[model samples]
Target: MKKLLVIYWTFFKMGAVCFGGGYAMLPILERELVKKRGWTTKENLIDYYAIGQCTPGVIAVNTSTFVGNEIGGIFGGIMGTLGFITPSIIIITLIAALLSNFAHIDMVQRAFGGIRICVCALMFMAVAKLWKSAVKDMLGTVIFIMVAGCSVFLDISPVIYVILAATVGIIADKIKSTSKE
Candidate 1:
């Protein structure tokens, strides 16, 4: 019970200030789960983030659910999900109720514009960290470049990139092993 509460509170706090999206929440999740409490490692958190991205739900909530499940169990997944979404639910509800009335205000538009800029900055920071950690070798660098270039230039789905990268990695590993042998 105590563990569940801690998981919920940690994720709740993380979700409260998390803006921009799941990637933007990475640093906060790292600080709370990996640095502050030692509940997970950076790599594991990254894995969770990856899985969350591929999953069928919001990435932040999905990552929180994975962390909570890692910390506790099914109940933890439930609590973590609930805690993470709680803020969004409340904020969206309030905003929905109030935003229409003020949607025409220039000040409101400016504030939202500023918020979007801040979110972009936050996402860039997260992406930088991920790049540093994930792109460790020449193969990783190649994959990174190819994926980024293709994603930007091509109309292909992300799943195709993931699959191609995975295949490339597996073949690269096999070649390396065979050469060493």
Candidate 2:
């Protein structure tokens, strides 16, 4: 019970402050889950993030669920997900109720503009960290370049890139293994 409550509170705090979606939340996730708590390694968190991206629903919520499930089974997953979303629900409700009254205010608009800038910075930091961690080998670098280029220039689905990368990774691994034998 105590563990569950702690999990809930931790994620609740994250949800409250994690602006700009999943990528922006990565630094907080790393600090709380990986560096501070030692609940999981960076590699595992990245893996969970990747999997979360591929799965249904928001990546932050899915990653929270995966980490909670890793920590405390099904109930943990439930608690984590609830904790992560509860803030959004409350905030959105309040904003919906109040934003119309303030929508025309210059200050409010400026505040939102500032917040957007901050979110962009946070997302860029997250991407830099992910790139440093994930793109190690030459193969990974090649894949990263190709994927980045394609994502920027092409209109293809992200899922297709993920699947193609996974396939390439598997084939490369098999070839490496065969060459050693």
Candidate 3:
């Protein structure tokens, strides 16, 4: 029970401040779950983030559920998901109620503009961290460049890239194993 509560509280705090979606949450996840809590490793968190992106629903919520389940089973997953979404629910409701009144205010618009800038900074940090962790080998660098280029210049589904990447990784691993024998 205590463990579950702690998980819920931890995710709740994450949810409250995780602006600009899942990428923006990466630093916080690294700090709280990987560095501070000792609950999971940075690699595992990145795996969770990747899987979360592929799965249905919000990435942060999905990642939290995966971590929570790892910590305390199914119930923990439920608690973590609830905790992560509760803040958004409350905040959205309040904003819906009050946004119309303040939407026209110059100060509110400027605040939003500032928040967008901050979110961009957060996302850049997250990308740098991901690059350091993920782009280690030549193969990884090649894949990164190809995907980045395609994503920038083409109008293709991201799912295709993910599928191709996974397929390439599996085939590369198999070939590498065969060459060693």
Which segments of candidate 3 are over 4 A away from where they belong? Answer: 1-76
- Provide the lowest-lDDT 10-residue window in model 3: 16-25
Q: Which ten residues in a row have the lowest lDDT in candidate 1?
A: 20-29
Q: Arrange candidates, best TM-score first.
A: 3, 2, 1
Candidate 2 structure quality by residue, lDDT tens digits, 144-166: 99999999999999999988999
TM-score of each: 0.60, 0.60, 0.62
Model 3 C-alpha lDDT per residue in residues 146-171, reported as the tens digit of each score:
99999999999999998899999999
> What do the candidate models score in CA lDDT, each in turn?
0.86, 0.91, 0.91
Model 1 lDDT per residue over 79-132, tens place? 998888888889999999899999889999999999999999978988887787
TM-score of 1: 0.60
Candidate 2 — which residues are off by over 4 angstroms? 1-73
Ranking by lDDT: 2, 3, 1
lDDT, residue 126, candidate 1? 81
Q: Give the TM-score of candidate 3.
A: 0.62
